[model samples]
Target: MNVETTVADSSLLRQRAFVAFWLARTCSSFGFQMFSVAVSWQIYSLTNSALALGMIGLMQFLPSVLLALPAGHLADQFDRRRIVICAQLIEWGALLALVLLTLFSWTDKTALWGLVFVLAVAKALEGPAMTSMLPSLVPPAILARATAANAVGGEAAVIVGPTLGGFLYVAGPDVVYSVSAAFYLLSLVLIGRIRYTRPQQPRLPASLSTLFAGIHFIRARKDVLGVISLDLFAVLLGGATALLPIFAKDILHTGPWGLGMLRGAPSIGALLVGLWLSRNKLEKNVGMIMFGSVAGFGVATLIFALSSQLWLSLLALAALGGFDMVSMVIRGSLVQLDTPDDMRGRVNAVNAIFINTSNQLGEFESGVLAAFMGAVPAAVLGGVGTLVVVGVWMVLFPHLRRRQKLENEAAQE
Candidate 1:
């Protein structure tokens, strides 16, 4: 196929609105990455307490749990575009607060932490609404590909953010926050520039049942529940990333920079795979692919857990990222396309919780297990648990197993 023709045919590249949103996603994600590093370092530098650094994660996580359901309801019942923009503005204000906090050389870190909490709340509201807004930007035919393109950008940002943030931090917290603020500003402008093609829909009043509707919807759909839960349990069990610093220092005999590289390895792997998926379409046996990819992730993590050599460990992490990317693309596409427009926000909010559980809670789980058992053994156990999850998911959710091609299946329906 001609490259130009292919580029021209791609909705993500060809549509100005999508391109703008894609750029906005890139900018905001990048800013968040940089902002997290700046905040963590600032907190540590100020308080000189590891516990203070740990609270950053907790502060960020609480809102995802508390506000997620309500935010999802808001997304469904209001303009998703406006919801995202407004949420972003809230984040921007938080960034501005950080800029001022650092610029003035304030001694009190609690105020800074408070602002971080505000950023957390802003991000919580942003996730569901912004994610649900994408389907409205493109046709059903292009949604899967769009999802792939998105994964590519997101994974890349995940890989780049910390490195960029750490590098910028050397200039001073003021410099780091300032640069991050610029990213947020650009993201806001790009999102604002998009010609809002999405039509407004009638929404339901906010109620207890309305908030619970997303949970009920997922529980009713075995395939959606299976996909979401499988990702949740598998990653929650298999996540070994939190122990990487220990591996770098104690096991591998590598330095702090080595820890950084190890921290980025999985995202780098996912980014490479995501780029490939963006170009090639997944048109056959998607469910099987998802299962196989997740199993591959388990095997890779197992290898990483057991390996002593740095090279082998890095390779295993890469494989883990690659496999997880495949699973992410399939699940993300399915979640967006399978649900109705009115319900997408609620569904995405539930999905966001699963994602947070797998990542944040998974980190907590890994740390706990490592404290009891050795880090190596804890990781090995997680890897084993992941394989077991894939096995169990296959037997339990045959509908997901039989799912051949997502887009084609939609066409058939």
Candidate 2:
């Protein structure tokens, strides 16, 4: 009875610190999702240039790449909770700046993207700490379940946030910014309230070696590097998220509301997958599962790229999200489980850079290519590129493919 009870209570929701962290993550995710939608729409409205749309991705990507190592160093050298709290506060202030700018009906569009750049800076700085903080809040036995739960909440936010942002954006950009600011503020408060477990380790000084430690660690670990690189190139080629506004308006002719639904479809699929993962968990052939998922993501993206029917596009996107969730859950668990507490911050920082490449950089790639060849061709070409990446990775990382389970891997020393 005691063992059963203990196992039942192992879920992160039953733990105070994890609950607080979960709330903080969810609220922050919601606000960021809204920011993504609002910014893409606003920028496109201000200037119809596809290249200008690409610039937003570059602006966000540059800060993240530049700050990755420093952010990891900061996370290692400080109380991670405090680092996250400060970042959330900065994010809050950035949203407020957006609110003020929009409310004033400001015509200086450059200033608008400038505030986005500021927000990106804060978020990039905080990424390492936040990723490293998760394991500290829960028992390792149920960490996968906790992560799945977190994904479910995050995916839910992804669904509601963009849809809400779009609907509210129609009311006015002022409304979206104000609400986003409020969510960020709430996340800040929630993170401030949490008390997380901190492992004792040597706090390295802010030197070049200390900053670049994450890079060094990744290079040493082939599995980590392989999975991270696979995701990076796959998403970099396959991602069409940043081009969503163009798809919504130009291809589908459905407007912002359709864009919201399009954006939400993937999250809806991910949410369902996340819930399932929380229950079953993975204990075998994780590598194969992850690779398969990524391939499925590409196939779905290809389908989405070719679809003109709203229903078909939405279904394709949902499949894309579902495939993405499987890999996300599996890879995230592997990263945290395989890494030591001391080095996790740095490793996660590097991981963030790789993952962000697929996201922001991928968006930039889409926009640039869209400007040249047209959106449909750009997306179709990306899907083909993603498939090629999968085939190449299978040959390059045979050990990763042979790995049978997440458990046998040794934690970083």
Candidate 3:
């Protein structure tokens, strides 16, 4: 089979709207990581409870689960750009409120919870709009590269944001919050420059029956369901990131900077891999790569849990991130390629919900288990559980591997 290496002559990176959106997302992602670190650190410092930190994750997830479907409907009905702008403004407002609370010496646990709640609300509304708009900016042929580039932008933020946040937190949490607010404001301005026309849809029923369409759409597609479930389980079981603060301060004796490294290491790995994949095409056997990468992620997590040395742990985390990015690129490209234009909003909303649910549920699980078995033991067990889930998934969905080679062959043909 002969494949056209250049499916389209348009350079995705050269597109102005894509560039603006990518830069805006990158900046916002950095701010997002800082906000996450600040909230977790503040809550843990005040209460010294893993449960409290987990509650922060739970608060964020609650709103997303409740609003995601409706938000997706809105994304389908309205101008996505407008939706994104409004969400960014709301997030900016939340950051400002946190900044004020900290500056006025009202940095109590209750105040922190209020801020977390508000940020969660903002993020919940933002998720669907931001995700649904991606396909409009880049052509279909280069969607994988665009996705990889977007992942790189996000991972770069993850790498920089935590390290910067930790240093600023050491100096003063107020400064970190202030900087975060500034980043959101910058994102709002940058988003203003993007000029893509959103797809129009006919008026549809606004009932519960209609709202459940996205779920039904995904349920009927075995491949979609399998991939989504695969991600859900692996992330839910293996993710112990919410407990990093506890491990860094109590177990590792590294403090905030060390905690930042633990947080940023994976993103560093992800960034490198994302950049590499963006240039090279994954034209064949992508499914095997995805499975292997996730298995590697589990192994890295297990290693990180057992290691006491900061550098060793960071190395393990970097490997985890690198592997995870491979899966991300493969899954993301598949989602974009398979979903119809009309269904993109709802499908992507479901995807966002799955991702957030997995992360939040993982956090809750980690927090609860850490309360009983200690963080190290809980994390290690979670990693092993993830590997088990992978094996089970492979047994259940042998088609995923087969489809990888099939898709590549089809593309080449």
> What is the RMSD of candidate 1?
3.5
lDDT of 1 by residue, 268-336 (tens): 898888888877888779899999999999899899999999999998998899899889989998888
Candidate 3 ranges with C-alpha deviation above 4 Å: 1-14, 38-55, 99-112, 168-174, 240-260, 305-312, 366-381, 405-413
Q: What lDDT is obtained when candidate 3 is compared to the true structure?
A: 0.82
Which residue pairs of candidate 2 clash?
A: none
Flag clash pairs in model 1.
none
TM-score of each: 0.93, 0.84, 0.83
Candidate 2 lDDT over residue span 95-168, tens digit each: 88887887877735688778878988999988999989988887776787888999998888877888799898
- By TM-score, the candidates rank as 1, 2, 3
- What stretches of model 2 exceed 4 Å from their correct place? 1-14, 36-58, 97-111, 169-174, 240-260, 305-310, 364-381, 408-413
Worst window of 10 by summed lDDT in candidate 2:
404-413
Show where candidate 1 strays beyond 4 Å.
1-14, 408-413
